[model samples]
Target: MTTAGEAVTASESVTEGESYDFVVVGAGACGLVAALAAREAGKSALVLEKLDEPGGNTTLSTGSVPGAGTRFQREAGIDDSPARMVEDLLRTSGPHEAEELVSWMAESSAEVIEWLVDEHAVGLYLITDYKHVGHSVPRLHAPADRNGANLTADLVRACDRAGVTIRTRTPVAGLLVEADRVAGVTVDPVDGVRHDIRAEAVLLASNGFAASRALLERWIPVMAHTPYHGGAGSTGESIVWAEQLGAALANETAYQAYAAVATEAGDILSWTTVELGAVIVGPDGHRLGDESVGYSAFAEVIASVASESFTIMDQRIYDYVSRNEPRFVKIIDLGCVPEAPDVTALAALIGCDGQTLAGTLAAAAASAAAGTADEFGRTDLAGNGLQAPYYVCRTHPALFHTQGGVAVDQHARVVSTSGTPITGLYAGGGVAAGISGRDGAAGYASGNGLSTAVGLGYAAGRHVGR
Candidate 1:
């Protein structure tokens, strides 16, 4: 009685011959959000993850995302707006190829967060403790643990509820091109067989090439020696595939770097240590440049100066930051951070002269208390100064993720080299040009990476559905 087309529609699976509305490559936060947006709008979507797990670098992050002018911010009595958010981002990142995206993301940030929480049942509460690395206000929203894995899990659950099929360990070998248009992709399964998935729209939300040494050397050569702390699923395959389709790449050299990853422990020391008046010391056990440049930019300074380093902090600052961040509290319990009662003991602990350590801490505390510039020109010292009972941790810089990929419009459509939209092709997250200024780690702002990932994915999913 029913035709073959009706049977395929009834199946709700993306079969080889039948076409879906949206086919999202990658099942990380970006791809999951994109699929959710599309499916929520009554569009058929299929999410393919090359890895067995869905979470990528997103899982590795703290999962903090910013929203401007949200109801939560208003309730918290904080004043903000799209314009203010744009100004903050530009002031940190400088001008770049995707300057317009800064405004676009800022404008839609609140809506994106709201949608994720209200519509998808994702648990995201506004963080009022302190403004992180590159923000001027307390606009960050995160889960209870401040882990992105929670966010990714919520999105996956949302996608499942929306009847979207998410297949893991299914790698997209290449795009199925019909002439100049990208129709779908050829996915390779474990059986060594290729399956064609035809879709009306394709989204490249796979990730950046931080895992690929060749691509890192090609674009971000300066960061070649840095530790790679990105998602294993990222090999620049998605970006390269898109570029081959005439997609224009922009801001390819920009990346998010962290200066405080424990060198031996293989854990992030949390930037809170530095933000709370801690200082980075080189091999000589002397303070380095400004710690206020943020973990992203200061990472470049660390890489250029020394491989072995130490973060010195006081008990009061450590307790305050650890109280707010559960991850740091765990780090404290791990005994990774050694404590010293005073400058002399601290010098003995780090193998340095007591006079030199005493002088450095004294000068820094004096500067913070007097509200004057130290030798490093750092301001905004939390808790005013470091007190007795200090803590020290050996740390190093790491490359988190590349901030460049396929260029897209505000709507997240992959644009060709001529600045025209590539038919049926969309991109977001690390697979798209980021809002950070072109090149180097200096331009990275707080939550800039996740803002682009979730913001652009939200846009692409909604726009593509229409």
Candidate 2:
């Protein structure tokens, strides 16, 4: 007879009150990977996705994950370690409440990458091209396409192979708490019928509350009015359910924002453009604060300075970045990038004074040439200077996702208000407090989201599966 936490076939009918070894809420990378890891440990796992299809905010991302001192990094002749990864992350994020969690993630990053690539056949290659934000080394691993949908699909396929059941259109309404311990979850009303699914352990990987205006206003009010570019499913059911269980929240004000979202194309302009020596200028053709602060941090600068702005890059930079980033290529094909031969023509395009535009470009070029900090304190010019035939795209700032939620332990167990692990309740990804700084978008390093997602997911699964 079937009992709680017993292994079951994927095709078996698990009715209400039946139990799974692990019940994963949300079908993003964190949930999928957690389910896969549980199944790998000879446990029957089930993944519940609120949306009709899988892949939450993870699908909208570039799918790049950072790993320090992996075999892939060794193969690529790069020297790195978990200590260095922690250092890099701490350098970018400053001090945060999740410092211990950051160390845990860094220590497990390489193992997670190896497990995904070697055991599960996830197609990941080390990105040696450029480190991208906040990294002192090239440790990002991504699919050839660098698309999160591909990563999510790979994890889903791996789960399927592992006999893990994934149920879509299944929104979790609340947690099933028994004697102050989570026993399972109550599914939201489905056609007016709700099902109480039980499990030995429950993992909340449902991302964050970026889509909820009320939550945004409550937590990160600075971005409450910003455009939300995150997944619609990020309504923060995890936070709601966990809070009822007395889960202690941490870094609730932190988030990841994108500075250069192409207004016309409705796609991010790829901050790689900025890292390659591009600059964001206001509608008045003046440079915004250091475009090199990384895209998430610069979003606040753009929001404070201009409602609508422009990202200016030359042909060489555009060609280089687009060749590697398929999304950028698509943006170019969509005619989002308009080209001008010189400053005068570019000013005409921006509808700003030519003299002001000329002076801005001239000052930036002088800074790049002298290898000194510009007026905005931007010193890292990846290239010599912006040459003629500049490409300018109208852009705006957008809130990509919330980086904070309920606090979690190193094993991703939800921490109670008393700082104890909430029994049987775990969280990862945007459901947990992030390693990003306690407030604002300035602390986000590239790949921080996915790093936490995959790392904590694996950790949670391993701990619970045992």
Candidate 3:
């Protein structure tokens, strides 16, 4: 952790840079969307990506976004509104520092999705089958293949056609301040040269600090020892700079975690298995805490109690989940998991006693069938509990991303600790305080990350460009 006295300077001295209407840091989904939004408003924009690649965690995600009252939802005969979305978000998040931002995001959800689909020509389909985690209704939209890379590719193509200048391998080292207002950023464009790029407004879409062990230990100590499963570029520099500049931070302890990343191959075992009534068992073949808590919240439970475990699901559940996610099907094809014909065979494969496993599953099955409480108090089983022909995969808890950081206003302008917007400064994506409450993963609803990323970015760009 660098102290306030320490300088964020590099050995290379700062030089001059070409100016633009807006300068965006990090070329992930947020930055891309922001630049596009700026271009649409007749403004010149430039995006600086630290890594060689543009997509950060956005490329690694499933690219799901919650859009209430979207055209796709209307076409699919689903009734939803911004009021319903706000209710769902507030119910999941409880109360937080950013309740007003929640309302703004909910109101802008449909606009953001429609803007991307219509003007930017990004392909998005409404997910009508099932809602995951905290949503009261199905409102998430994703790419056809449910791959984030495809979404990133589309964003890149749109940015290219829109004439947005993206400079990869360029990292912002520090912000340039003049008269207590952020004017631009100091960047290192490789070859040992630094440039001071001035701009009318700056947007920090550089994501969060999940990859930083120091920040994780400082905030969420429970997850400090777990392996981080997010983009490598997220080292907390943006948050650090913003804090040093007097920006207030919130929800620092809240983060998104996965309960079931493959132990052997280190791949994500889709949470759909658990959501569809699969159970996680310890070495003794006993069920863990309520699996209905969803994957992000269950991750903390899995990490604290056991180092490793098996996700046991019946053939019916496996077939149903895999039928939708082709990427998950590839995990099965790679021999990362095993399928067995019966309970005894599955137990042998997972190194558990047959009778013990059978008893463990039977109790849950009885509860699920009765539509009552299970032994672990899980009520919402996606379907009836497992029967013969089961599937099991070895998995462990993993941290995906931090959900909190610098606070921002409705237009994604950075807000100082004094409850005033920091002049000419803006932030979005993981750099901003999230709607997942002040701490813990339990408050996280599905698509909360992208909602903040895309929603705030669009608003910020449109505000600055206009």
Candidate 4:
């Protein structure tokens, strides 16, 4: 039997006397999906979440979901297939990924998206061939808001409609095991009550250890100071319990670091730079990498840089976006400098060397005059140049999410170091050791985290005889 160090309360006792076919811990994307899948299979499922709201960090995310061979792609006439997707992921992430798990993700990604659209009524549209963190293909899908909040809102609505009981502010402290199988979970209700709820299977859909400093120090040594933007509830308590029950962990070192994050706030802001034709420069005011590359690639370079970099652009870039793409204009205007007429003062605020900034602008102008070189791959810069006034903003590498956790098999069963299954327990989402390795932004693929969460959660739900 699983138990928490805390005591049981009156409200927890109500759940303690109950039982379910499937008990899903965490109400984040993966947990919600797993609960829905179990309910679809006619199983009674209960979702235990430590937070009051349903969505976890996912709701706070830019809602880009990546999938290959999706119906949406077919409708859009985008050429894609599971095999090609797998090859691309392996190329980006390398051998650090579990072949079996990666294969499962690539093969079933389309179905997962389809489920969201058809079953959950989630509205999705094909945006630009948007590449995520490290994806080589244009496979990112987003709702109208381009934030995962839409997805989470729809999932929560669907779950509520389907009568999937969600226990908010209730944390799963441990798993209940019967013989070699997980039979239920022990919960610490928000009301300060503790109780045991039996289930045929338990899905640890909780998030990764990004929010838990203690867990990171123990499992991922390199991530001690990585700032987290996701929910604080993703503390890896489930992983800790699984390990206590003899489960093995894998790929505990992988994480996703965004290239340009706001210094005052941890919000991801570098995508605006790329979209607005800005080049990132190091402390010495030199261009760092090809700005034309995707955000993931640039972020990796920034993370490896000795000093945090800054994005340099011109008012013309801002004006072009404001006139053409109003949506992008907001990002640029809010983040860019020289909102006034003075460019040199903006440079001072952004901490760029005045002379060095002037030199860079002149060089860019010469390149533009020659019409031969493109700094970030766009020929538009050939004529435009930064001109007299320029804009710059300080940026730093931001650790937004962890990509690794307890390693699991294809069925989402936590795997032992000896390549054996730790029966009765399962993991998904960032908590499940990520398929991506330590290769940086080049290792990113669109929808890597969300797809893995849904795919593995689905697999785990089905395995529980739901």
Candidate closest to the true structure, highest TM-score: 3
Q: Residue-wise lDDT of candidate 1 within 190-304, one digit each (tens)?
A: 6545567888899998889999999999999998878887789888888988887789999999999999887657878888778767898875778878989999999888788
Q: Write the per-residue lDDT of candidate 2 for residues 421-449, one digit (tens) a residue.
A: 98899999999999898999999999999
Position 232, candidate 2: lDDT: 95
Model 4 global lDDT (CA atoms, 0 to 1)? 0.70
Tens-place lDDT per residue, model 4, 1-466, is: 4332234333445455778988999988898888888888888989998888888877867666677888888888788887888888777778784666788888888888888788789766665543444555567777765667787888889888888998899887766666667777878777876778888778888887778888778765555665556677878777777776666666666666566665544455536445555667777766776655555555666665634777666676656545533444445556544453454664576567767866666666666677856564444343656654666556776556677767788788887667788766788997787777643445656567787777888788777653
- The worst-scoring run of ten residues by lDDT in candidate 3 lies at 1-10
Evaluated at residue 110, the lDDT of candidate 1 is: 98
Alpha-carbon runs more than 4 Å astray in model 4: 2-15, 270-272, 290-300, 303-308, 313-345, 361-392, 438-442
lDDT, candidate 3, equals: 0.86
TM-score of candidate 1 on Cα atoms, chains taken together: 0.94
How far off is residue 6 in model 4, in Å? 7.8
Residue 373, model 1: lDDT of 84
How many collisions per candidate? 0, 0, 0, 13
Cα-based lDDT for every prediction: 0.85, 0.88, 0.86, 0.70
Off by over 4 Å in 2: 1-15, 189-192
RMSD of each: 4.8, 4.2, 2.4, 3.9
Ranking by TM-score: 3, 2, 1, 4
> Candidate 2: global Cα-lDDT?
0.88
- Per-model TM against the reference: 0.94, 0.95, 0.96, 0.86
